[model samples]
Target: MNKKYQVFISSTYDDLKEEREQVIKAVLEMGHIPVGMEMFSAGDEEQWKLIARQIEQTDYYVIIVGHRYGSETEDGISYTEKEYDYASSLGVPTLGFVISDDASWPSSRIDKSDKKLKKLEAFKSKVKSKLVHFWESKDDLHGKVSISLMKTMNLNPRIGWVRATDAPTTEATQELVRLSAENSTLRKKIEGFKTIEQPDEEKRLVHILDDNTRKFKVRRKSDKGRWDDAEKVRNTLLEIFLMIAPTLVNESSSKTIAKEIAFEHVGNNWFRTWPIGDNKIKGMIADLVALDLVQPSKKKHSVNDKEEYWSLTKLGNSILKRARRIQLEEGIDTLEDKSEEDF
Candidate 1:
């Protein structure tokens, strides 16, 4: 059975009611179930428990950090912070959208309860990587928010945007049929170019043979041993790299491509992971090189010879096109299948 992607939105209700509604609408438009606190009354303890359950079930947790997010009530807990804490405890992949200076930053600085402001500040620091900030009146709110959500959900941005007018009409049915036939012909020609298995004696180049071998194998299991949610995120990153491979010509450096991907997907946390801390990202790049999706450039250098630049190969471009098609067909289902079992 197909799984629906669930998203939990955490925000201060007083500050972002309108914006939150817009966000909820966008999420529904994108075909994901949006869970927000507005669905329940504040006085119901049972409702809060249900909200926590929803957070646990969510694939992505989106926290909207406004100026008054941490402001406390008589009970000594800010509702926004409480939701964030609960989501973090469940090890959910979370993203934060902070209201920028353009949005009214709270001025009163009132702490109705003890040290609530300080607590909020500390919590913000802890989850800073997931945080994305934007001006209130940005012309492209949908684009910006959608891009950020795609990154957090590990989706390919190219496939995220869908046009209502892209569907074929009765007048264009013949054209569509003709194009489909042409596409099938091209696919056959492409398949013909695939390398066939070579004889053992012909594959004797030691370094080349070793390089072609798989370093690790990931397998799917029916019950146990499913890939974790983090792996799903890694796969999304791989898909994005494949999608952008074609446009990045031989002149484009690895740094340039990485920056573009970061800009398109990274959102407000762009500078947080500078220099690449994770081995997974590095491994993905190595895989790209091995698959000839990208090739090293002799002219470009990453500060020195120790670091090399890479550009996409022809085969890489084909893989990217295929990846986009897969994304369109499956949407976020591919990621959900990989992460659901782990959760």
Candidate 2:
């Protein structure tokens, strides 16, 4: 809905004519209405009531306090301060603009009267307690008003004025109210669901990797001699992941262990080396993550920023201990669906 908010601009007029004009321009440009005192009135019940009624109707109450302290009441408080008090009491969304300490102005604009200066200082202090913005010059005030008003309106939206014809009918209003309550209820239910812990990563990983290890069998090169070659080992990326995942401790050790596992399992012997390719290792790691077996840590080594690390999850740890105990239990290539790890 295209609604215009009425913002009551409360400030002394004569000393801040330029300031008020800038504020009015800022408010008007943003499509909101600005209300301010055009004529000075005496401190009386009728005048104050009129001002209070205006503040009550406004969506926002803004004040720009300069050096001059305007006419005061019998209680010695400025009329501007009285207006601020009324606005504050009504709980209006108020924005205050105070002149900086180093701001330069004409002698006429400056409050030379010691009593009025003290009251102005007190008023400034009161405004500072709320949402107060600082300004040094007219140009600075213009920019500040524009930015501050934009931000304030976004954060604290008000019940703005609209044409009576544009307003919703009572029946439509009732429907809207019903929908609003239902929406709130649905939001609370969604929030309750958010509190529930997500599915276990470990269990999912173990399921994908269950009994999936590659089988390997070693044979003696000579009839009466010890085994010499790992040539019989299954050459698969899953085998590499199985080899290094269990031994991993922290970030620094995972890569070192991965390379070592690749070299030992893939290379087979000390003399003839067949090093595992980095690309192959990387691809297997990616699959492991997709399976949720291992998660890459977000933390980086202080000395080596580019260093990457991964750790096995809870189920990964259990799976690590179980090794290739697939399902069946006894054979050299065993554990093939013989236990809970089969899942």
Question: Using lDDT as the measure, which candidate wins?
Answer: 2
The sequence of per-residue lDDT tens digits that candidate 2 reaches over residues 167-256 is 999999999999999999999999888967788544444445544554433322222222344334443444555556544422323344
lDDT per residue (tens digit) for residues 163-251 in model 1: 44765578799888999999999999988997885453212222232233222212122212233411122334344464345435433
Deviation in Å, model 1, residue 207 alpha carbon: 17
The Cα local distance difference test for each model comes to: 0.55, 0.67
For candidate 2, the per-residue lDDT at 337 reads 28
Tell me model 1's lDDT, rounded to 2 decimals. 0.55
lDDT of 2: 0.67
